[model samples]
Every structure is written in C-alpha cells, then in structure tokens.
Target: MKTVCCCTVLLLLVLIPTCCHGGNILVFPTEGSHWINMEILLKALHSRGHNVTIARASKTWYIKDNPLYYKTFIVPVEQSLVDGDFLKKMFSVFIKLEQGTLTLTSFFQMAIGLLDKKLNIYNSVSSFVPALLDNVELMRKLNETKFDLVLTDPCWGNGAILAKYMNLPLVYNVRWLMPEEAHFAIAPSPLSYIPMTGSGLTDKMTFFQRVKNIILYLMTAIQSTFASKFVYQPLCEKYLGPDCDFNQIQNDADIWLMRTDFVFDYPRPTMPNVVYMGGFHCKPPEPLPDDMEEFVQSSGEHGVIIMSISTFVNELPEDLADGIAAAFAKLPQKVIWSFRGPKPSTLGNNTLLTEWMPQKDLVGHPKVKLFVSQGGTNGVQEALCHGVPVVGFPLVYDQYDNLLRLQEKGGAKILTLRAVDTDDGFLKAMQEVLNEPSYRQNMQRLSRLHRDQPMKPIDTALFWIEYVIRHKGAAHLKAQSNRMPWYVYHSVDVVLFLTGAVMLTLLATVMFIRCLWKSVCRRKVKLE
Candidate 1:
C-alpha cells in the first residue's frame, strides 16, 4: 500500500509540471458565424491546458461570458456592432440584390446603397477601438496578465489594433480580413490566374473572364484602400501613434491559421507563416438524437437531404420558401431544413423544418444524399469534409466566390436566388445533383485529398500555436514583403528603374554612332 502511494505521488508530480507549462493565451474574436469556429479552437486550447482569456465587447452579439473554459474581459460599448435584427436586415437586402432584376439606374442605386451599409458597419466596429483603448483599468489589467500571444480573427480589425497596443505576438484564425480575402493582404495573389473574390471566375479563365477578374480585384483594392485610409487610419493615429500604418500592422501577425485548404481552394502562392487549417473545425459526426435518427432511418433507399443557409439567415422570402417546399414535396427523399420564421404554405409532410439542426452531423450521415447550402465557408468546408455534393444558393459577400470554387472542382453546383425563385429552377438544380454520380465521386475524391494530410489540421494548428509560445514569436517564418511599400512589393519601382536604364543606354548608343558617322564624313572630305 505504501509503495502504491509513492508511485501515485510521483505521477502527480510529473503531471503537475506538464500542466504548469501551458501557455497564457489572449483571444480577440469576431462576432456571428466566425465565432462558431473560433469557439471550437478556444475549446481545443482549453482542453490542452492552455489558459485562455477572451476580450469581448459588453454588447457583443455572439460572444457570451463563459467561466467554465475561458475568462472574459468585457469592454464596455455604447451599442453592439451587429445583432439578429441587423443581420436579418442585411440578409434581406442581399436577397433582394440577388433576385432583383436590375436596370442601369437600379444597379447604380444598389451599388451606392451597399457602399453606405459597408461604411456604417466599419464605423460601428471601429467605435470599439476607442472604447477599449481609452479604458485605463482594462488596459492595466491586460498588461498585468502578460499573455504569451494574441489569437484573433482579423475580420474585426480591432484585434490587430489591440495586439499592436499590447505588444504581443499576433496569430490569426482567419479567412477574410475586412474588405478583402486574407491572402490578398499577406501573400502573392497574382490576378492573372488567381480568381478574385466576388468575381465568380475560376483559375482557368478565358480572355474576358481574366478581364473580369482583374476589374474585380482593382475594385476590391480600392475598397480596401478606402477602409484603411478613412476607417482604420484615423484610429491608428490617435491610439497607436502617427508612424503606425494600419496596413502594415494588419499584416503583422506572426502566424495566420488560414481557414482554407489547397484541395478546396485554387492553387496559389502562400507564405511560410500562413498555416492552412481550412476544416479544422470539422470532425467525425456524433450520433444524432433519437427522433432525428429515426427520421433519417425512415428515409431508407431514397436517402435524406440536408438544407441549411447557416445562422445569418432566419428565413427566405415567402414565395421562394413556397417554391422550395413545393419542390421538396415532389421528391421522394426526406428533407431536414434548418429554418426559422413562418412555415411555408406548401411545406411537404416529408420535410422537417426546425429552428436549428446539427448541420455537420446531418451532412456526415450515410443516408444524406445531398446538401443544400448558402455557400458560407464553414458550411462548404463541412460539406467537402463529409463528401456530400452541394447545390449552393449564394446570397452575398464571399458566398458566390466560395461556391464558384466548389463548382469549378465539379463537387457542387451554384443556383442564384433569381434561379431558385423561378418555377422549376430550384427543383431542377436539386435533381441534377442527386441524379449525377460524378458530383458524389468528385466530392469524395476531394474529401480523401483533404484528409490525406500528414497531421490533422487542428493538431497542426495547435503545434504552431505551441511553437509560437516556445520561441516567443514566429518572426523568422514571416516574410519581409509585408514591411515593404506597395511599389517595392509589386516591383513597380524596379520596373520603372529598369525602363529608365534601357532608355538611357539606347540614347547613348545612338549618340556614339552619330559621332562616328560625323568623323567618317570628315575623313572622306580630307581624302578628297
């Protein structure tokens, strides 16, 4: 008994030191669907014994106080940046924009309206910068915490600012960095082959398609510049000082846990510090609830179809919803749709409508034949991970772009809102995906490739996080290109320098020939 007690004590001593070595991590997360994956990451960190402290706004929409896993440092705010109502309104506008039959005037009006809404959102988010930085007590507490690093979602912009202010290494769990894709900010994104977000083009482009890609890229660049100059620059000057540029600091993160995979995304140049952990949140599905399992089992030979547009959407327009319902009624398969708001008048008895459903679990189920999605990153990645073919109804933002990649790979098909609103369009799109074996085959191939990595994406991300903690930061892995000016990074200055040198050399050669010609003429005259 005494020998056993001694062995137990020795084990405890060894384990205690392991627990004590866990890193102190600070997190600044974005609200809405982004937080879903971020929460998964935070939980993983906590499970590994790391101490996590989140900085959340007092009026945040999604981030809530969680004492069990991580501590919350709430920063007081006048109002929340986003809420359910705001999302609903924005989605309504997006639906209208997608389904609207636009003339020239209407298109211009829509563009202006979108620009106004974007500016408003930027201003709302930027408001938190001053509110958090101006709080003396909060700043003091944060400094005293002495966190090893700041893990953040750069979509909010405030995270980058906060990291800079804290003087800690920044690591991003990111896909989009407000106003553009994260890769555009830090990596070499060549416009010729690499499709721009919202362009709806593929890597394999024709002449006109490449033109469209370049135009879309330029427009996005213009928007990004405007956001940096007007929205983020003033805040940086006031809080971080005059010499601090928003663009430099925005790309200053030591590691970028990019929520993208080469298997799903187009092949493009990437950076050393940018780690691809695209579907890190995805895992094998757990058993469904008893009732849900029973429903899935009842489908039998015909199989089941899961439909979800993700959290941002509460419901579709009445007519659109009715069309979808009537189409589902015609099909033999059972449908599980995640929806809220009023039920469609034509909802079939075979269809189950709930406020929420276990999306990833449903997609991973063996009986699931098809996945109807709204083309959000998480949903698309989940579908890819589960080897389910998708019929995407893209509404706004990067949804179109995300779906386009899947379509290009032959794993999914995209149906516009206008198409879905048409009489037989949604039904036809669904039938195409269901009847075709190629869709399933291609998606399964992609799933295999995505899963064939040396290590699981989440494990890879965790290793890099620990790597950063051990080394203090990943400064050696970062590229110097982030520090270079635009002209230097793009080699515009070098191109101009080379052009000038060539012109001078040509002139000098011409002058020497002219002088030789004159001397030859003089010698001939003297001989005469």
Candidate 2:
C-alpha cells in the first residue's frame, strides 16, 4: 500500500508538467435566470476539477448555497435592488409591446417606469465600487485571493470595474442572445445588417426593416452612451478613481461565453474569442418525479402543452389564465403550466396545473406536443433541443428577439397579448401553432442540427475555458476591432476624409473648366 501511494504521487507530479490541472474561476453573474445559465457553465467546470468561486447578490439568493463552488461570496444586498418590483413592472411594460401594438404615450409611460426602476437597481449595483472603496479590508481580502480570471454577466457593467480593480483578466458570461456592449467590445457587426435586440426583426431584413433596425441600434447606442456618462462612468470614477472608465474595461475580457448558437440563428460573423454556447443549459432529460410522470402518461394520445414563463416574473393574469385554460380544455391535449400564485378558478380538468414543472424534462417528453411560453432565450433554446414547437407569448427584454428567431425558423408563432382586455387572439394563435405540421417538421430539423453539432455546447465551452487557462489570458484571440476607437471602428473618420477630398477635387475641376472656357472665348475674340 505504501509503495502504491508513492507511485500515485509520482504519477501526479509527472502529469503536472504536461497538463493544466485546473483554474480558479470567479463568477459574478447577474440576477434571475441569467445566473442559472452561468451556474451551468461553472458547475460543468467544477465537475471537471476546476476550483470555482461565486459572488452572488443577496437580493436574489433565496436558495441554499451552491455546493459546486469552493466558496460563495454573498454581497450585501442593496435596498434599491431588493425593494423594487422591477421584474413585475418590466413584464407589465412588455405586455404592451406584443405584436407592436404599443401606443407612444403608453410605451413612453412604461419605458419611464422601467427606466426609473432599472436605474435605481443598477445604481445600487454600481455602488459595488463604493462598498469596496469604503471597506479597505474587504478589498484587501478580495485582492489577496490569487484569482486567474473574472467571469461575469456584463449587464450591470460593475463586473468590468471589479476585474479592473483586481487586475485580473475577464471572461464575459453573456446571458442575452447578445448584449449590445458585447458587440461594441469585440465583434464588427454592421448596424445595417445585424439587428439590435428588442427590434422585433430578424437578420433577414427588408429595406424598411433595415431602416428600422438602424434606428433601433442608434437609439440603443444613445441610451448606452447617456447611461455611461451619467450613471456607470461616474460610479467607476467615484470608487475606481478618476482614471478608470467603464468602457475601457468592457473589451478587456479574454473570452466571451455568449449564450447563442448558429443552429438557432442565421449565419453571422463571430470572432474567435466569442464562443456561442447557446444551448449550454440543455441537458439530457432527467427522470420526471412520480406525479409529473403520471400526469404526462395519463395524457395518452392527446399529448401536452407546456406554458413555462422561465423565471422571476409576475404570473399571468387570472382572466388571461382562464382564457388560456379554456382554450386548452377545448383541445384533446393536457396542459402543464409553471405558474406562481393562486390557481385560476376556471382551470380545466384536462389541464393538470402545477405551480412549477421540470421544463426541460417535460419538453423532451414524447407526450409534450407544443410549448406555450414567454419566449425567454433559455426557454426557446430548451424547446429547440427537444423538437417541441412553440406558441410564443413574448414579454420584456430579449423575448421578442428570441421569438423572432423561432418565427424565422418556422417552428413557432407569436401569441400577442398587447391589449389586457382580451385573450381571444392568444387562443387563435395557440391553435394556429398546434394545427401546423410544418412547425413540428422545422423544430425536428433544428433539434437534429443542434444535436449533430461538431461538439456538444458543454464540451465546446470546456475546451475553450481550459484553452484560455493553458495559454494565460489568450490575448492573441482578441479582434483588431476591439482596440479601435468608435469613430475608426465604424469608419466615420474615413468617410469624412473621403468626403473632404471629393469636395476639394470637385472645386478644383470646376475652377479649371471655367478658366479654360474664359481663355477660349478670349482667343476666339482675338482671332475675329
């Protein structure tokens, strides 16, 4: 036994030279389902023998501590974050945006409410800097930890400051289909072609849609600039000192683990550092608990309709639930809804309503025929993995963009609930999706492509992560565009230079022509 122990130690020592044992990855993910996406990546890394540490906001840390990480840092939850109905209000705003029916006054009203709530929440997040600044001991303790990389969702922008303060490399965990700042950081996507999030347009745009896409991109850019100047930059200056700017550190990331994939998207350009791990959350269907299995099996030939609204949002209205319930009752299928709060009075016998269900597992089940969802990125990705067609009832954030992707894929139809007064439209939309054979065919095609990828999303993520650690930051993978100024990146400077040269040449040519005309006239007069 002693000899065997000695041999094991020797083997480990020899392997150390050739292999990267593991890396210490610090992940600071945003609130809600975005954290779930990051945890999937982190948990996978942890299983592969990497030491992972997580820092979470106290506001949303409702569950017990995660055992996947070596340590969990619980930041003191700010009042602004904890004390707002941001998600609920944001969902309310999105209810107005279904099918582009939102009027200017109502849209502006919702926008103002959402912006005010978000600014407060993000202001508190930005105060992460001030908290670090005020507590030297905390900062010292954090700095003392020999972290190799800083992994975070860049939505808050505070993570960039944290990475800058720690002098560590960054790896962005983008939870949206793609965040605008992320493209600003690394990719050279043209505003003319690449549709911005919330545009409700796909990559294949008509002339009018492209114009609209351009307008949306410009609007988003303006909003981001204003926020940086007023909100984020000032906070960084206050805590990170005056020299520190939020944007300077945005692209400082060594890698981007973007939650997007080509199978679910149109063909588009992506940089080497940008890894599309869209279906990372997708896992083999876990065994359904006894009740869920019984409910699904009971459905028989009718199958089931799944209405899972992802996470952390207000429940559907009771009346709308009744209307949806009524529609499901009329069909031969069973319905499983992951709803919160009280059960609707009009819920049907065929519909086995649960407050929550194992979404991925049910979607993968042979009995689940169609998914009726809020069209969250994760939910959409989950649906695509199982070949389940969707009846998308999109709400706030990237839901519209996600739904548009599905619509383009021909596997889903929009169920607009813009007006709160009715559910007639939703019922018809649900029926339309269910009755269509093409939806099922397209979804199956997507599922096959997703599964038949060169490598599984998880494996791809693991490879790239280990590659980064082995090469020490992998700085060479960064695009040249990441280093260019905004003016130079968009070629605004080149346009100006070319315009000036053209104006000068035109002026000189006109002068020479007029002069020659005058000289010819004088010569003709002399000859006469």
Candidate 3:
C-alpha cells in the first residue's frame, strides 16, 4: 500500500506540470480590427501561464502594453498595407455595390470590379513576404524562439508561411462562417443545403438556389486557386524553399479553430480537428461610460436603439446619414447613434450622437431595445450575446450573409440604405421591430443558448490549444478528407461508375430487344 501510494503521487507530480506549464505559443493574425475577437483566446492562454508572442506587420501593431504578450514583433514590411483610410475606401466601395440599382448582369459586373480591387490589395499586402525574408535579424530572432505551436488566421498567407519557417505545427483560426475553401479544408459541406455566402442564399435553399450555390462554390474554388497560384505560391517558393507551395504549407496545418457556434450558424458536420469557439470574445458587458450611461438612461420607458455601422461606419454617405437621422426623429425610441461622417445638419431631439460608444456594454444594458448595425460578425455576436433583436443594413464582406442568416433565424429584420431614403419607410421598420414579440423571444432564446454552453468558450478554446501542444500538434485529429482529392472526397468516381452502369444496361436492353425481334421475323419468314 505504501509503495502504491508513492507511485501514484510520483505520477501526479509528473502529470501536473504537463497541464499547468503550457508551451510557448506564437500567434500570427493579419493586420486589422478582425483580430480583436480572436485576441480573447490568445489573452486567456497568456494568463494561463503560456508564453504568448504576437508577431505582426507594423500597420497591425496595436496591442497595448500588457504582460499577456511576452514579446511583440512589428516586422516593417515595405509600407502599411492596412490603415484606417484604406479600410474606409474598401467599405465605401462595398456600400456602392450593395446599394447600387443592380440587375443580375450589373451585380456580376460590379463583383468583377470589387475582385480587381481586392486582387490589387492582396498583391501589395502579400509582398510583405520579400521584406520579411530579406530581414536576417528578424529571421534569426524568430528561429531562436522555438515556439511549440502556431495559431494562424486563414484570411492571410503570412501565418501559414511563418509556421513553416519556424518549424511549428499550424492551427487555422478562421474568423468566418463560410467560403467554399473553408468547407473543403475543414469538412464536406454539401451544396444541397449549405449556401454560398454573398450569393444571398440561406440554409433552406430552393433547388434553383442550390444550383446557384454550387456554381458559386465552384467559382470560389477557382478564385482561391488562382489567387494562391499568383500571390501565395510564389512567396512560399521564394521564402521557404524552391519546391514549397501555399497548398502544401496549409495542408500541413494540424487543426482548425473556427469562429462559429450553432446559436448563430446552421447545423453542419464538424471534424475533430476543428474546434468552434464562437463567442469567446464576448466578455460580460461592463457598465457604460459616464456620458453614455446618461444617454441610455434618458430613454426611460421607451428604451434606446443602439445604432452603429461598420468599421468604416463613419464614412456614411452624406445623404444616407441625414436620412437615417431623419428616420430616427420619427421614432418613439431614443437613438444613441455612433456617427463617423460629417454631422447631420438636422439632428433629432431624441437622438444623441457620438464618435464612439462601448457597443457591447450598450447591447447588454436592459434599457437597450434594438441594434441597428452593419452585421459584421463581432457586432452581430454582441447583439446576440445580450438578447437584443437586430436590424441589419449590411454592406459587404460577410455582412449580407450574416444578416440573411439572422432573418431566417427570426431574430432580426433587414433594411436597405434605400429604405432610409424617406422617414416613413425606415420609421415603419423600426416600429415593427419594437412592437414585435417574436423577434425579442427568438433573440432571448438564442442568447440563452449561446450563454448556456456546457463549457465557457474561453476554456474550450484554451483546452484545444494546449491539447495541440501536449499532443505535439494533435495531427491525429486532422481529417483524412484533407488529403483526399476533390473527386474522392465528393465520391465523383462512384457517381460516374453508377451513371456508366445505367447507360450500359440500357444499351444491352435495346440490343437484346432488336435481336429477339429479328429472330422472330426470320422464323416467321421461314415458316411461311
């Protein structure tokens, strides 16, 4: 008994440190506000005693002085590819595309234009590779760190390459719901149900809509391949080694940390390699700042509508801003509007304007009635976290798709920039939301589900990251489908075999019938 006790205690002593002393973790997120939500997981890991390092471009160097980051590298790569002004231009272009009077052809033509702009940006931004490769000091510093694992964002190419360069296992941290490429990477997303984002289709797809989804999915695959071949592939070859390609580097990634949960997303198959940490970034709402608290309190019984737009929300078109203000004037609810553009000449008595507001805090407040937003993932998730019904005026990116998903879920309403043209139309929509019981009920239900998960999102996310480290990248969890060819993954060969068998059987039937008829005719002639 004494010997057994000693052995058990010795085993625990060895195992305890394995759990508590997590390894050196390196995070490589692209340059933007998109990294905000994802930072939650990284912060948690840092607090849990892991040494976390954030290596990013100079344009993306926004992390404050916190002990959470043990080291920070702002790799000066040419010029700032991303900045406040650049994002505003991109958002403005999307608003035009979303609000323009567009036919089917015109929509596609507009899409082509958008693609050209994105391609240019991607080319310029991805050129950071040459600079990073050129910096011998930076290379030496990264090599010496000896990170145990790398957390990657799928949106950019640098994370994948950096993982390779550092000889670390790659784990994709996707901050999106859908793109055909993501589906292919994580699991099989059937076209019969899963809709292509930005195609304006939902999970409950009509046959025609499914057809469009399939077409869009194929187009998306082609586009990813083209971009990779031109932009990322060459960089991999030039930086890592002669034979390396982007596909090869990405395929070696051990796991995926997808930012989605069933509370907001439709039912879909998930692989063991993929962990969904949807609301990890949603901290419990803090009290609103002094001035903002007073603004919400003034609403009294009517409650306030928290109106916000995109990151470039401040770039609202002059007329749209004025029209939105006009619509707010007709509503009974007080409006706390976060305006970025030129101030509206006619401000409503019930409306309070600010350059910025703590959006999550306002949404969590009991006095908040509805959220008028652009439907970005973080904004939408915040509203959902607080059980507030939504009104979306989505402009671009995944905003439109996010809104449609909410509309189908019965938790929100959709409005157009055009709808705010006159006060009456927008007022009617706001009133509809205010008066509707179903919207509030659905939102509350979703909010409860999101909050009532078996484990906190932060814990779940941290467990998996450590799990990867403990298991030396957890390669066993990676789906074999990742290695399968497209034809094999979709059973294309099986389909072709069945089709060919059917055609061959029909041919044999026809031949047999003709032979029998000819034989019958010959016998009849001989008998006659």
Candidate 4:
C-alpha cells in the first residue's frame, strides 16, 4: 500500500507539469528579422519554463549563428533564392505596381484574381509552387517530431494551413501593419473597405481627399481579392490537403499577435484573442562605439542625423547614391550613412560611411537628433521607442502606410521617391525634421504611451502561446461569427432588404384588389 501511494504521487507530479505547465512550440517566420524577433519571444517563454523550437527556412543566417538559443530545424528549400538579387528585382516591380505607377490591365487583373486562383499561374507556378511544395514536405516531416502548437508569420498563410493539418493550434504573428486580407482573416477590422492600416479619419480630409480615398479603397480590394484567390489558395491546398477550405483556415487561427501599438495606429475594435504586441524587438541598450560617440559629441550644439535604408536597399543606383551624398554634403551637422559598397567620393567631410553600425545603440545616443529611414515598421518602432524624430522615405509594402501614420501624428516627415532624386528636397526635409522640436516631443509622448501598456508584448505573446498548449486548442477563443455564411453574418442587411421587398409586394397587391373592385362596380352601375 505504501509503495503504491508513492508511485501514484510521483505520477501526479510529472503529469501535472506536463499537462498544465508547458508544451513544445514550433515557430515559422517568413524572414530573418522575423526569426530574430521570435527568438526573443522564445527566450522569454523559456525563462518561464516553456519548451520552444523554431522550424525556419534554411536561408536565415541569423539562426546559424545563434544555435544555443533555439532548437533550430531547417526546412528544405533553396535558401539562395530566398534573399537573392532576383527576388529583390521582383519585389521592386511589385512595389511599383502597388504604388500605382505600373498600370494593371483589367483583363490581366481579372485573370489573376478569379479564374487563375493559383497566383500568376504562368509565372509563379514553376518557381514558387515548387518551393512551397518542398516546404510543405519539410513541415510534414517536422510534424512527426511532435509539437503542441504552431506560431506562424501572418504573411505566410501556408503555415496556418500546416498547423491545421497537424491538428495543432495556431497563433498568427504579424510583423507589419495588417494588410486587408490578413485583417479580415484573423482580426476583422471595422474599416474593411479601406486598405489603409487603421480606420479612416475623414474629419480632417477635404472633399477631394475623401473621394480619392474611396477610389483607392475600391481598387485595392478588387486587386487583393484576386491575388489571394490565385497565390494563397494554391499554396494552402497543396499543404493542408485538397479538402481544406482556404477561407475557413484563416478564421480557425487560435490567436493573432499584432506588431503594432495604439500610439501609432488609429483606434479600432479588436477581439480578446487578438493582441497588440508591438515593440517586442526592443531590447536592453548596448554601448555605442567610442568613435561614433565621439563623432556625435564633437558636433557640439549641432546634432547628428543617422541615415540607413536597412538591408532592402542593397543595390541602390549610382544616381541615387550621388543624390544622397549631395544632400549630406549640405547638412551642417555630421551624417553617418550605412552603405553596403564603396563610399562615394562625393561625400563631404561632414559625412561618415560604414558597411554597418549598431542601429539601436546609435538611435539611443544623446546627441543623435533625427533618423532618416526607409520607414520599415521595426525601424520606426525603434526610433519611436527611443524618442527620436524621423524623416521617412518609404519604398514598398506597409512602409508607405506607416509613414503616413507617422506623418499624421507629427513625429515624422514623408519624403516620396520623387523627392529623393533631388539634393535640395532631401536636404530640406532632413533639416525640417531635425531642427523642429515638436517632432521629437510628440514621438517621446507616443513612446511613453507605448511603454506604459499593461504588459510587455513578449509576455503577452508567450501567455497566449501557453494558453493554447494547455487547452489543447483554444477553440473557445475563436469567433463564432467566422463559421457563419456571408449572408447570415450580415443578417441586419438581409433583414433590411427583406423588409423593403415585403412592403413593395403588399402595396402592389392592394392596388390590384382596388382596381378589380372598381371595374366590378362600374359594370354594375352601367347595368342599372
């Protein structure tokens, strides 16, 4: 009896921790920066005694260096093509189209959206489909290893499908402002018609701006619907199985983690399962290099501007480089530019060029007055977190939207690509952002609001991850409205239409009866 009791007690102790405490988590990120951010979240989880693993594309070099931190598994795919120059060129073209520069023919747009439903079937079918298939196979293999939950980048909807196939709960983590498709899927934003990040604040808009906004929204929706039908559906079906419904898969996600803060975005309704986990990437401050510190300090009363386009602008044109150099030459304050290749001879004595610099350290420096950036979400968040002003030159994707939000909030100035070609324009924009104290003060106020949230983003992410694992799938948290048909979900609209039809039919019937009675009465009177 004593031996049996001891055995039972030991069993309960082990089972309680396994069942109630932690479970294996698998993270799939679209790129290296995403993987790096996930690593930070995983470390936070690990500190709280949770087991985590990362299943990433082999192309991520950051993972190779930090083996000790994560149990890393590389999915089999051509890592070379993932970040190569060819992909960059394709991205550039995509951005141009997104910016309304390249005219999308109506026929081509319709074909890509509805019937072709495999995403540029002629072009991407040979290249991208194979890569997706290969990654799916790798995911299948990884599933055999047993994971309790899957965390996926919202951009990679295929990962959500894989999580469904594995019968594991999924958490969608968005690294940027949610695109319209993603916004609809996990957390339905109130401003469904608009492609812009947040609700449309039309109070400040002129009549012309309102009209333009509406037109832009309609075009964006039409184009996005077709793109998803083609590109997203094929990739999802190939992995999740032929029977899987792509629309349903998105709604089935257990939770959504947004890399955005209320400080930066317009207010909108959100669900409990949807969380805003912005600034998760901000970490402990590191000391700036002695030379860089000295350079900033040597500027005396004049403050320095830190300029970098991030990794996306690796092969900028010589003309662009010359324009940038010309702008820096005119600035009275010192400039530190992060350029990949050889320094341009046109750079003036006031400029310093390096292949790389510690970005966060530089942003946090006391003498660093302003930041001129490509306006990547992470870059903007970091600048805001440190209370630095910005001059945003957005290139692609959500960068433009972020820039608009920053500009609206008075924390930054937007310098369009058209302006970047000229020296005077770029110089003037930089000078305005740097010299103005309002930009810095507004950003600092926003930073405080972002930081004073109830919980750190990393902690919020980990809590939901563990919650899903403990519950075996947090189906309770998913919106029941997701399961309803489109007609049924919009029942109020349906009711209004039905009521109008009924009223019209009743009026018609009454008119017909009165006409019949009048004809009979007329015949009787004539007979009399």
Candidate 4 per-residue C-alpha lDDT over 1-528 given as tens digits, one digit per residue, 9 for 90 to 100: 999999999999988876557677877655546655666676787777666777655554445535555577765455431444544554455445433455668436643553343333222322433464466566576767788888877664556666776778888777442235355554554443234533233225666666766666566666555655665666666666676666677667887778886787666566667877888777656887899888878888887888887575565556567778888898888888888766775789888898888887888777888889888787888888888899977775667777777788889998765576654788889888877889999989888888897787778777787788778877777787778776788797789899999999999999999999999999999999
Q: What digit string (tens of lDDT, one per residue) describes model 3 on residues 1-528? A: 999999999999998986776788888765555577657767778778888887767664344435545578667866675555656766776666555644678667756876786787778767666676678998788778878899867676777887887778877778542234365556767778777777888778888898899888888888778778888888888778887767757766787777778788878777777777786778777988887788788888999998988766447777677888888888878899888767887678999988888887888899999999988888888888778999988887678788877788888999877777744667788888889999989999888999998788778888888888888787787777766677987899999999999999999999999999999999999999
| Candidate 3: Cα lDDT at 134 | 77
Q: Is candidate 2 or 4 superior in lDDT?
A: 2
lDDT of 1 by residue, 313-392 (tens): 76788877888888899899999989887999999989999887988788899999999999999999999998999999
The number of clashing residue pairs in model 4 is 5
Tell me which residue pairs clash in candidate 4. Answer: 113-226, 117-230, 118-230, 119-230, 119-231
Q: How well does candidate 3 score on lDDT at residue 81?
A: 58
The order of the candidates by TM-score, greatest first, is 1, 2, 3, 4
The TM-scores, one per candidate, come to 0.95, 0.89, 0.87, 0.81
The CA lDDT at 291 in model 1 is 96
Task: Please give the range of 10 consecutive residues that has the lowest summed lDDT in model 3.
Answer: 176-185
Higher lDDT: candidate 2 or 3? Answer: 3
Best of the two (3, 4) by TM-score:
3
Candidate 2 residues 316-406, lDDT tens each? 6666666676677777888888878677776788888777788878888888899988888888999999899998777767787788888
Top candidate by TM-score = 1
Candidate 1 deviation (Cα RMSD): 2.0
Whole-model Cα lDDT of every candidate shown, in order: 0.89, 0.76, 0.78, 0.70
Please give the lDDT score for candidate 2: 0.76
